[model samples]
Target: MHIGKPHEATTRICQASAETVEVRGRDLCRDLMGRLSFTEYFCLLLTGREPTDNQRCFLDLLLIAIAEHGMMPTVQAARMTLAADPDSLQGALAAGLLGCGPVLVGTSERCGKLLVEAQSRLAAGDDAKVVALQMLQDIRKTGGKLPGFGHPVHRPTDPRAERILELADARGVSGPHIAMARNFRAAAAEVWGKPLVMNVSMPIAAVLLDLDFPVATIKAVPLLARTGGLLAHLAEEQQNPIGFTMAAHAEAAVTYKNTDEGGG
Candidate 1:
């Protein structure tokens, strides 16, 4: 079945000439007088609220941090969707976003919520480090990895996390959320018995919480920013004469043994 046939058409937006500098029905553009940062555009689109200088800076840092990772699932999907000759750029982007679903690009917001939970446990007179440790242990008991701490591609420290933290501290972002990050870091260190820095999501989570965005909004904000790259890849892929084709492939398959089987 052609699952993504409609996505290509969805990305096509009407362009206006210099003589006709206005486009109607795109409310998000109303706030952009000119030369707005990606953060500003993202905030405008997601919240319909222009941010203060501080909020803008914070959001900008986050968006810049996760802006693109070449050949990631999202980008690959965008290229592949275009290869399929979808109807529009929007359709390619939609297909890309579908690939990003929960397994790939959906953890930033969950990490934000986890930071809040870690803080609440601290405020209730529990040691933040201990609380974080216990939480990690609980997740392990349930067969889950601790979120927001490690990444396959970014080891030791997520460079984006490092960059955003630098910006966040320079802007004087302080309070329990910051404290929670610090405490969580210590706990992760103890658990790993070595230094384990926060990944991109953690710093963004801290910054968003500091800016008073509900933790639930963290993932939404990043996803919104990501659509830009998604669209760009889609458009670029369209130039290929062959249209969208699988850019790469793997030939290996895994062997599995059933645990619930009787000798037959």
Candidate 2:
């Protein structure tokens, strides 16, 4: 049984032989291994082409920027999963990665799409500010949340986002996407009647788009980066387990009642 069309199937990503492996048209062991850093290798693998200096720099910078953030929910989930089953490290990591959604590592993908749509409207000759404001209005009309414009902890502006933008401008890579994100920041403040946090996800998407990264896999950035972070958390969990403690805290913080009576 097949779920989708199964026809002429092919893959240009990789192939292997008796003694050699090919990746993106390069010899894996010869041209790739030991020569390219993981960041460079990742870029090549993703785009099937070598990244320029700027692309490479930003990719590395972004990975470092988002790889770890204290004990985020994703980290907590992984740690908890590990505490429950100490032997299955992979399972614990999967538990964390599976939680990537609108509020987590997946936010960058939404932000990327948002920037791309704004760019499209700007391509139609509309003013950038007007395009941004109209898109903000549309999102508000649908009661949708803006993806990259707020954070629970990072107030006023996300330092990571600001750093990425500053680096993009210094490197001369801040293109229309970055501009659109900033425009949206301004429009959002006006539309929402107050300033909102311009979080890291906005600059992440903007820089990747400006660097011509693939839109469909923009989430891969955060997914891969957070995987590194989660692995670190899992390692620490083994030494000083706090997952169960976190679970206990969570249980104590919330009040529960039977649904037939009342719930909170």
Candidate 3:
């Protein structure tokens, strides 16, 4: 039985033969192993080109900013997975990474898409504010939550979002996407009749887009960053071992009330 087209079996990402390993057209060991920072190598691998200084700096900053957030579900999942299978680091990492979804680390991609759409409208000669307002209205009408606009803990504003915008302004990378994000913030307030906190996801998306990073790969930023965080958690879990404690706490916190009082 044959699978995909014969051409589909190949990968453009990397190639390894006995004598050499090539990645994105560069000899990985000779050209990149010692010289490029992991962050730079990540950019090279994703983009098939080296990042500009600004891109490297912003990417590093965004990664650090989003990397750790104290006991998020992903971390908990990783820690618990490690506790259950102390021998498998890869399994623990996979357990955490698997949790990256629309409600978590994946929001960056959605927010990037949102900004990209808004930019398209602006390029088509739509007023920025009008586009933002219409977007909020359309989202609300469709009963969809506005991506990157609110957070459970950060009220009124998200400090991470503010800091990202500040750095982008200082570095001169605050381009149209960033401006549109701000416009959308104001428009969201007007449309909702209440201020919505622009979360880190929005700034992350805006900054990456401003840096010309592809929307399709925006989620990779958070995933990569959070992997670092998960590793950290796993390291601590190895030494301190809180995964079972967390599981026990969770079990204790939920009261399994029987809906059918006497039926059981």
Candidate 4:
């Protein structure tokens, strides 16, 4: 018995024939090989269209901004995975990418969706501050935390986030979405009675939204950037060998506790 649909199979992303390969109707070898930057090519591959100049520039900037954050959990996972296997590069990379979830590199997508929700409220004629506050209140009532509003290490603001917004302003790409993010920041401070740091995810979402990036693919930006970082870490892991040491450190860092034995 078939578990699901078994007869559906099609791909519009690429078509290859006996002598040539094509992506989005462009010849891979002759038309795109040296002409498109990797960022431009990534845009094409994902959206089936080339990005505008601003889109390309911001995309490249965001990628660079997120590519390396020294010794992040994903990097450590990749390093340890490489150290354990020492042969399976793909496995090591997969180990790292698997860790990109709501708490880590995946927050950009969630924040983008949140901003879009706020934009909808704005479109409905509510003031930006009201929308932000109501959204925060609603999230809090449900025991939910606001996405993209705080970082463990970066206080007040994330420099990468600030740079992205600054560049967006300079390039005239800061639009309603960015405005909504800033309004959310202000509203969060008022609601929480303290200044909460705005991390890179918010601006990553805001600027990408301003650039007309598809919300569905927002997470891909971080995933792709972190892949590069993971590769770098894996390479260094091969050279320096730390996976076993990290494992040993973890073993030493934890202790089992028994209530009866402790009381006795």
Best by lDDT: 3
Give lDDT tens digits, candidate 2, residues 142-206.
99999998888988778999999999999999998998999999999999999999999989999
**Which 10 residues in a row give candidate 3 its minimum summed lDDT?**
2-11
Question: Which pairs of residues collide in model 3?
Answer: none
Best by TM-score: 2
**Candidate 3, residues 131-185: lDDT per residue as tens digits?**
9999989998899989998899998789999999999999899999999999989
With a 3 Å backbone cut-off (N, CA, C), the pairs that clash in candidate 2 are none
Instruction: Put down candidate 1 lDDT per residue, 134-214, tens digits, no spaces.
Output: 887677678876667777787777888887777677878755776677777877777667877678777777888888777
Please estimate how well model 3 matches the true structure, expressed as its whole-model Cα lDDT.
Answer: 0.93
| Ranking 2 against 3 by TM-score, winner | 2
Instruction: Report, for all candidates in order, the number of backbone clashes.
Output: 13, 0, 0, 0
> Every model's Cα RMSD, please?
8.0, 1.5, 1.8, 1.9
Candidate 4 lDDT score relative to the true structure: 0.90
State each model's CA lDDT, in order.
0.70, 0.92, 0.93, 0.90
TM-score of each: 0.75, 0.96, 0.95, 0.94
Q: What range of 10 consecutive residues in model 1 has the weakest lDDT sum?
A: 242-251
Clashing pairs in 4: none
Question: TM-score of predicted model 3?
Answer: 0.95
